[model samples]
Target: MSQSQLVELDEAAVLGHAGQALAHVYFPTDCLISLLTHRVQPRSFEVGQLGYEGMLGAAAALGVSASAFDAVVTGAGRAWQIELPHLRALTRASRSLTLLMTRFLYFELSQMGALAACAHFHTLEQRLARFLLMSVDRLRVADLKITHEALSLILGVRRASVTLAAGAFQEQGWIQYSRGHMLVLSRAGLLQVVCACYRQDLSTYDQVMLGSTAAQ
Candidate 1:
């Protein structure tokens, strides 16, 4: 087994390179990481997000050696690292941990399904609102350092569309944007504008992680 270490990552840092077998699993303590699918056009769409509630190298737990998504740090956070061998051993020995991680995996799959439907059926404005709500929930913070270009890639839309949607939000006083930073001003208003998928995903996470005691 390899030694356990705590790693601190800065924003936009690569947690795992594409096509590389995960050598270590990372349990995020204060950081948020995004798992994105890189495309031929050099575009990327976020497929999953990991925070203090989950670990980064989840594919390895399911017996997959390689990752399809590029794992990048979306926020500054701390992660406890354990080598692959140690992680495997721990998972084998602990049924509780295995069940807990399985629950997270199920939630992740549901989130992906929700995102796929959202991409197909929802408008850019609705999708953007949903994205903001999800980010706020994961970071538990109001301010987000993101740009229209970044949002465009994540939403699989044109930069112009992102700009327009963001403008609408700003005009309504739902958010304050300056430079590349966005501060959510009206959480309730944002939620009202977002589609139902956001709440559905949140409910799944709450039920899986916190049971009936989860916050609404």
Candidate 2:
């Protein structure tokens, strides 16, 4: 841990951009990183998210240096970062490190695919609930700070839709959302509204990342 540097990431800060070569791999402890992608129009749309459970830019160690999506700091906090060259050297020196990176990168790809499908097919409310639940799991906090505009950019939806979803969730006693602040009041209630994709993603993570036979 002493070798890893801790850095504070501000909200909406871009960590990786399209076609840009990655210099560092980030291991988020309390921060949240969202991978944004778009086609036809230049707009931010989230395709995947990472937190304490994962790392961003590990592909660089495998010779995939350029980023395909915009990796942004969505939930502001701290993360541990290692230089790409250093990580690559470490992986070369340690077979266990190489194996871990291979496993993590594979899991990250599956997570991205799942997120892309959920974003396209699921309704805004359902998608919102799923992401919100995922966020809470990563943050391990009951309260969240988010703007409707920011969520719109991430979810690829209109801010008005987020407004509606937030209101409805509030009415159901799921959260208390107002003025860019949201306090999750009922995790169980949110689980009820979120699509099956959320649970499936968790189960996959448990199987592949955690090596757990018990389902999530």
Candidate 3:
């Protein structure tokens, strides 16, 4: 922990490119990092997210050196970063730390699976709601500095689709959007609009990561 340094992440900053070797692990204090899976250049979708509640480079901590997805900073804020080798050495020195990291890795994989299923089976509105809800929960801010174009990239949809859904949300007084900013007006309304997968994702994290932390 003492070796870790506090760093500020700018929005859209690429932390680690896909298939590259990871050099550091980041634990966000308020930032949001998206793990993007790519099909082609400029065509990628978010598979997982890390924030204050989670750490990037779980695979590295678990002994995998290569990154499977690109890690991009979605929300600009601060985080604690440590060298990969240093983190791995600390894990080797502590059994409880190893267990906690193992559980976090499981939680991350579970989220990816759940989100993939949600993308295939759920409506765009529901998925959008889920994304916004998750973003706010992670960033602890209602006014998100994002645009419809950015939302489309994250949700793997056309920009027009995101515009349509966001328009509807604004009409319903559930949110307000202008330029590149979006303010969530009603969490309850979003809860009603989001799919069951949101709750399931939260439950999985609570059971896996939180339970591990508690046991430790």
Candidate closest to the true structure, highest TM-score: 3
Of candidate 2, the 10-residue stretch with the lowest lDDT total is: 207-216
What is the C-alpha lDDT profile of model 2 across 5-102, one tens digit per residue?
98999998888887899878899999899989842374567888898998998788877869888898889999998888888887889887777788
lDDT (tens digit, per residue) of candidate 1 on 1-216:
347788888877786877888887888887788777764485667777777778887668766788777888777767888888788778889887777777787887787778878888988888889888878777778898777877877788889988889999999999999888889999988988899988888788888778933442
Q: How would the candidate models be sorted by TM-score, starting from the highest?
A: 3, 2, 1
Instruction: Give all TM-scores, in the order shown.
Output: 0.88, 0.93, 0.96
The alpha-carbon lDDT assigned to residue 129 of candidate 1 equals 92
**How far in Å is the alpha carbon of 10 misplaced in model 2?**
0.8
In candidate 1, the residue pairs with backbone N, CA or C atoms under 3 Å apart (3 or more residues apart, or in different chains) clash, namely 31-77
Give the clash count for each candidate.
1, 0, 0
**What is the Cα-based TM-score of model 2?**
0.93
Model 1 spans with C-alpha error above 4 angstroms: 1-3, 212-216
